[model samples]
Target chain A: PAPDSAAQGLALARNGQLTKPPGALGRLEDLAIWLAGWQGREKPQASAPQVVIFAANHGIAARGVSAFPPQVTAQMVANFRHGGAAINQLSRTFGASLGVHALDLDQPTADFTQGPAMTEAEVVSALATGWNAVDPEADLLVTGEMGIGNTTSAAAIAAALLGGNAQDWVGRGTGVDDHGLARKAETVRAGLVAHADALHDPLEVLRRLGGREIAAMTGAIARARMERVAVVLDGFICCAAALVLQRLHEGALDHCIAGHVSAEAGHGRLLAALGKDPLLALGLRLGEGSGAALALGVVQGAIACHSGMATFAEAGVSGA
Target chain B: PAPDSAAQGLALARNGQLTKPPGALGRLEDLAIWLAGWQGREKPQASAPQVVIFAANHGIAARGVSAFPPQVTAQMVANFRHGGAAINQLSRTFGASLGVHALDLDQPTADFTQGPAMTEAEVVSALATGWNAVDPEADLLVTGEMGIGNTTSAAAIAAALLGGNAQDWVGRGTGVDDHGLARKAETVRAGLVAHADALHDPLEVLRRLGGREIAAMTGAIARARMERVAVVLDGFICCAAALVLQRLHEGALDHCIAGHVSAEAGHGRLLAALGKDPLLALGLRLGEGSGAALALGVVQGAIACHSGMATFAEAGVSGA
Candidate 1:
């Protein structure tokens, strides 16, 4: 479904009469109008916002690309279940409903350097997990991921779709040292070379060079668009997943806003390619939907001001 | 009272052992530790945050330095009183206590282009209004302003304290035109020249070239510091107020963090001078503490993550 132009028009009209100078609210004004258009309401609200976290083990972890071992993915999933991760805290802070899904944690995706990271059937299952995870009642959605060696996969996907070398897209994930960073870049290069033929199709890129968690994010975002849930995309790996959808369909991410550009090396370039100006930029590099979860507060604030503020006539304030 | 070094040390130690990589949260980590230091708790929270808005009328508006008429200041104060303003909505969104102090809005200050903006006694009254408005129970504080043509006064104060010409500080405030901007620069230059001898003293400069609202912000910030409440200073006008305190006493703003750098031309330079790094930079120029109120969400999220996340040992997650 397309955005409601009528609702957007009304929102713009209301924004002008809110008593402050025109455009004084800056990007917040845009955020409110965008939400209004997507929610198809002149006064849209994300009263039931949702955040989903996908966890999967990556076979690429064997290549020494990440600082932490892959087993930490499962451990952190348990932490999330215990309400003990950063995302869990953030979800509570912003009143977001939290869900975590682990896709075959015991069966790691195949290393992309050797072949496709996942078979077609396996990729389909991962996509279904994400698609099924979104709540119909949710007015806003945020997706995050947990996989130690996923940065290598994300870098591969970005480079494959966006015409960048391994160096341009690679960065230290999970605090990898300089030597480990070189190893990650080399792994990205190998993965891209191994799947050069399959890379033309975006879904193939997801299966060949992306992890289950990444694939899940891609599917969840698509589901949000279908559900008319305005989405706030997370940091680097999350944006890489979104880029896959972007290449696959025009306006696939029209419902989405980049929550924040991560400190990751490729994120700024990726956001530029996607033409997204992020909401927050505190140099955060942590994933698990933390950035987007944090950004939910900003969106809610924008919506509240748009919906709850008084017009010049209502307040009896003189306007320009 | 000084920040508790012991609390900050404990916070730093706790941050090191959190589930994510070291410093993955970037400036948020600094925010949390800073909060802990001021709140004197290893796991501090801003459960009772307060936002104070100081509204006043500036005589400088008569010079055509602002796009809006002088009456807009009093009208906006009424708008705030009726809860129709942006700050009201933001306070409700973030669970902050909102206080609006219109410091004699019917009494426009003397135009600094010809003479001092306020008498010493008048400045003291405004400061006391701000100082008394702060809730002692507030764990976090944000101060903002509303005054047509206050930007001219703010620019004049920044120029006086930080050594810059009018051109370096002047910008389009409330959608000023090219001619209005030129007029603003001229007003600031005239104000600076009119009070050149008293410019060496920060408080004297505040009385001579600053508004009651600006003085009130300076008082509120000082009050927050005395109460050991962490402060998030707002845009150019707010920063200029904090700068008076910064110049009057060394490390006066150590308890403060810049909320956001406004789109105003002098704000980035002001932040640079204060040696403060802003939390958000969304190009927001709204002065009703909107930027600081929005940033309260960011600060709250950072504290939630810092205080609530399990340590690696507790989560049983492997660490680097």
Candidate 2:
């Protein structure tokens, strides 16, 4: 049996116990009804939505392509641990469990103990680690990422996937000026030129130019598909991972939902390639599952409207 | 004594807290710290924010200026009463109170006769009515409006206030076509020209060209200022009322904050007039306080950061 899409959910929405006008809840109503079918019930609940923020070091950061230093990754990861990052604050507000994982793509670990980025074996292990951290019966999953200059990595990965110049996908990251942006674009072009043939396979792409966190997130998407857990993808970095996962397994995209369309330069092209419409667009460039965290609320609204609002029949209102 | 706009409830953050290095939380920390001071409390709480939506009929609707009929004002008001409007759902989600007031601007109650766009007596009474509805002691006040052909009315009102050409301020209302937009702009020009001499006073301008809801919202903004409550202004119609309120009482402008800059042609100009920075700009043209309602979460985040979250010294972190 295949996982349900919004169309299937809309169908089940018609059968709900309440008899409201069709599409009464608007987007929210539609989402709620869709979720009900996904849950295989009349009402779907998201009791425990898990969000994973994969933090990685980007090779482009070494080129002074970002306003902040690459060290901000470790600094932000530590901040996340301390509940100071925007993602940490937002996840707490939404009552979603947030996990942070480090992907070693830009810089080697102290003593060079950890492999660069991650090998296929490491990616699988990391996936197992993240999956084990969540309940086997988790209701939903959200994928997010954070890395200074990761936009460059994302653009390069996107260029490799879509056969475009990295210059086409590079954008302003953390408010960099025109000169820094130019350098960032140049660095992406260089990385793509260096790793073009090597990135033909998704795993090779991750190994050649992908960050450790990107590989793990790809694995997480693959695992979430197998488990039939609903997955929401946030912004550029996670989209790169989802693109990889989609290529590795055609059906994996079925479990995925694009949370929001980011204003990042390459995000639109990536979304087009993936054939997804983001649930929201607020010009948010801050990636950290903030978009997915917001989508959870939308999903919750959908569920509530499905379960709680009085239908036209119940309210005795004439149908449209 | 005047309300202390400068009372240092919280300091503008130059450094991140959480016992971490400087600049760890990045822009979020600065945003949080800025909000803390603005709220006038060490821990400014927005648990019960207010969202006031004012609805009226526009004289320009007489020109057949909108997709829906003018009666949709009353119909949507009924929708609001029935809690079917998008803003209603959003307010419920944010735990904010939604206040709807009818301003007799478009179609006055006759024989039981009141003038279109309430008289000064009606405006004062409506102010009291709306103010009394705000719980008097709420944390924040959000003001938005709905009126068919309101873009025409709003543009006229804004032009009168800014002393600009009406056509320059006018935009398409509810997806009006090029022909409709041209006609609408012409209507604004006509209204402005007709009302210019009569609108010697801002209140008179509102009465001459504004809708019932705009007048009511103007009164509400004034009352919010008198009571020292922060008002979050939404889009052009609200901006029009805000301009009226500012003209009537310059001090009223001090109590207002911009929720988002609308994609409306004149919204930016109006916002610039008041030296206000809108918190978000997502090209939103939907009325009903949708943009303002969306911005509630950000204001809440600002308040939470101000009220919650330990200070650098409190968290034992180094300061800049």
- Candidate maximizing DockQ: 1
In the range B175-256, model 2's lDDT, one tens digit per residue, is 6678788887777776666665766688777767776676667777777766767777888888888898777766568767
How far off is residue B85 in model 1, in Å? Answer: 0.6
What digit string (tens of lDDT, one per residue) describes model 1 on residues A1-320? 78899999999999988878888888889999999999999999966799999999999899999999889999999999999999999999899999999999999999889999999999999999999999977879999999889888899999999987899999987789999999998999998889889878999999999989999999899988888888998988999999999999888889999899889888999998888999888888989999999999889889889999999889887776
Clash list (residue pairs), candidate 1: none
lDDT accuracy of residue B248 in candidate 2: 74
Interface RMSD of candidate 2, in Å, is 6.4
Residue-wise C-alpha lDDT for candidate 2, range A1-320, written one tens digit per residue: 35555545554654343332233233555555555555555656665888888777755566777777776677667667777666665666556798888765345321111223455676566556555544446678887777777777677678777787767888875667798889877876777666655667876666656666666677777777667777878888889888887777676687677877777778878988898877766566767776667666556545544555444454443332
Worst 10 residues of 2 chain A by lDDT: A108-117
DockQ in order: 0.83, 0.12
Query: How much lDDT does candidate 1 score?
Result: 0.91
Assess candidate 2 and give its lDDT: 0.66
Candidate 1 structure quality by residue, lDDT tens digits, B84-130: 89999999989999988889988999989899999999999999999
